[model samples]
Target chain A: MNFFFGIQNNLFSSKLEIPIFKNDGTFLEETILYKLKIQDLEWKIEIFDKSKKNNFFFHVNSSDVNNNDIFFIGRHENLKKFKSNKLIVLNEFTSLVPHGYHYRSNLRVNINKGGFSSYQSDYPYKMTPVKGSVVTSLASVTNFNADKNYIFFKNIYELPIQENFKIYIVDLKEKKIKTFFEAKTNYSNFFEIKKEYILPEMFLVSKNYVGIPIYISEKNGQISMEHTNPPTSNILNSDRIDIVKKFKRELNEIIN
Target chain B: MKSLIRKIINLDFSIQVRNTLNIIPKGIQKKVSNQSSTSDAFIWRTDNNFTTKFKFSDILKLYFKIKKSHVELHFYSKFNNLITIKKIYDLDFSNEVVISKNLLGGIEDYGVFYAYHIMDEKKSQNISVNNKCYTGFSKDKEFYSFVHGNTLVRTFDYYTNNQNELVQTSFIKNKNYLIQKFFYSSEKNELFFTNPASKSVKFDINGKNFKLKKGHSKLISINDNFVKIRSNCFYFRPIAFTYNEKYFDVYHC
Candidate 1:
């Protein structure tokens, strides 16, 4: 508790400087987590109130400023969309006061999923603050630790008495599952897709980029979905449809 | 020349409108942007060092509801098994206020994940009439153990004695057999147990026998130096002796 307050106080007093990093173009594909860079190691802070509203402020030391113009940019989650907001240009250091209505829960000083830039010249790129749909083509930043964490998602349906099926790595070694992705219900039709279980290395690398396809099958008295084949990268120049296409292809491969 | 001047005036007017729209508040920015197609762009920079510096495995986040107004956070750092408890009073997205924090030796049992407050030993005492496995720590915080049925199934002790260094000790119990009675005497440093039999017979700490049909207590004495068959013995301090099958056998020793 003391350490947390100490960190926060140091941030506001400009004794601590937090670096913000971005890798949007060619470098996005190579790394699982992007690294931050510091222009002058300025103190970046986000203060929040009880109303679930937050304010972002940056304290710049006069000695650290090598340029006159400073550019501050913020990207935060808006409802369901994660988009970049307007860029502010500050001439004087005092102009870097607290601004904007940030969500309290989403406020963070360093461990956030956005970028900030402070520069002397005008921002080279045009700023689009409009709320837009999330881009699926962007490389995912999710990573799973084999020892502690797992990739968890659900495939739920409501039409037939509410069927909820989950996919999990039951056996990481053999990638074997006597029953995987099948909704455990009184319903007779339930089969899991098992062929898509790739090697541990490949599964860990590609699980974030793509998802395993669910295949529906009719066998004996049960009509079930078979879980087969591991997921592959859908990164075809930022097209999310690659995920659907990969699923469809795997379904066909299992059926034929 | 007149038409060219008119086109330049329109361009200037649109840019002015766009700049004016940006000045509106954030809540209104959404509605106004929906009406018009213009927007402002901002570059996003994330601190990637956060993810690299702390792996998800290192920190186990546990939430405990303290009253209705606030929620207590227990961040169990697996690196050193340090438990830091912080509180958020308003239940909003604001920074949490540190209430009280302490460092535990390590995760004593699998129940810590399910247990809200490990300090509250009663919370970890999971009991059932049928065959059940229970995990918890001893009172003095010196010893942690997992018991199944009537046996000290697994023990994790952090005592620093040359003879009995109480670090982590995981003992796998035979799942097929159910221990009807288990007694551990810290004074003697011995353990005793029996299998399911007549409920009329109950063994006390003095190794006095009521019935000896399925008693494996004598056999334990041969293998384990901590087991002795004697009468009029001094009761073990922090004795983890199970009197009945229903009681939680967590002792201070």
Candidate 2:
């Protein structure tokens, strides 16, 4: 029996429901739903619109689903890429290794209530709009929002040392270019604060890291955050920090 | 429970709707602020320091933001002691903005007792929200006497002796429309009958809905059953009663 299933590899455990369109341009509806086996756990998931054969449906047997506290799944694109056309979960038990390369868990966040933010990172190696290019590894990313005039990054200067993150602004409307900030080292993880009213600006980073806060006044360019004690050893490119993505929903939605 | 009582007392049902109405594009909102007779006083944030606190006022200026993490408070007063505050983000069971208003003696009298509303750098003479007055102007009288909220004894522009009111019998003999011409109408849409020679005013609301009308043989100022329009003078004033639905718009000038 020829069976088929889709495997989506993530840097975190569990799965993020990013509804993808089926061949018929809608959700693939499948009856007689069964579990896709990953290690000891068989989580129930559905695949639809078979190629006129139930043979098109099968099971995805990957690493064991050991970690349940997983909330988000992303790729550290600066590391080696994941297996093409395969689904893997990220968790405590999941391998930090790419198909043929070695890597480490570079960032971690603890969000409790909401995660229904509209912003999602595009796996630039495959999804980047630029022409055909080969990416070196999978430790980082750069974002381009259609609504923003500037491409903002916080961890650029620390490119390879800083986990290979790049923050740049591409003017979607004007087709211009603006590079806001990039981390000089792998220590800083930058993202946006969805809420508007908090006087103190917001960005999320691993609590274990000693990264200082940075901000650029929307009213004025006055930006300031924690000054590194050993300022000379700092990998910060700019004193001003920018929020990359705004989290809108509660934490539970973000957590699996 | 005490705080809940305060919320009830200082509530501006008008403002609740105003916030929603603001969301709508300007071209669509035909409904202006409601005709609320009541206004509230509140203790707003005195300063946006590390610690937040403030004094109360019967006259409060408030602005609300939906996406804001914490509500901001700003105060602009010519008075040396300016109060301000910034409330934190604590969304619990019955958390609300803490408020308090001054409990001093209220002011009264007429001719539009002017207090300034400093809006972003511009100073506008905004009358107090609540009618904290010793007495109210009789949209029902001639001379349109300005009575005191405190004494209720001191009179201006009219005979001082009369208590409940200053009558029209004496003033009409010589100055027929002098009250209409000289004395200002705190209200618009003031109804006057020159042929019949009786001064009466009514807010022309929703077709013949006459709320209140009063004046001399010459002129009158009108206040109606609907209070916000009354204080805002949307009804008749100075001249005869005129029905103008467009009067209450704050930004329209």
RMSD of each: 31.8, 28.1
Q: What are the lDDT figures for the candidates, one per model?
A: 0.20, 0.20
Q: Report the C-alpha lDDT of model 1 over A1-256, residue by residue, as the tens digit.
A: 0000001121111111111211000111111111111223221223211121111212233233221122232332211231112222211111221221111110111101111111011111111121111111000111111111112121211111222333333332243332333332112222322333322211221211122222222112111111222212111112324543543333333222
Every model's TM-score:
0.19, 0.16
Runs in model 1 lying further than 4 Å from the true structure? A1-146, A164-179, A184-248, A251-256, B1-19, B22-253
Which CAPRI level is candidate 2?
Answer: incorrect
For model 1 the local lDDT of residue B95 reads 20
Q: What is each candidate's fraction of native interface contacts (fnat)? A: 0.00, 0.00
lDDT of 2 by residue, A145-254 (tens): 11111112222111112233233222222333223234332222343322221211111222111232321111111111111111111111121111011111111122
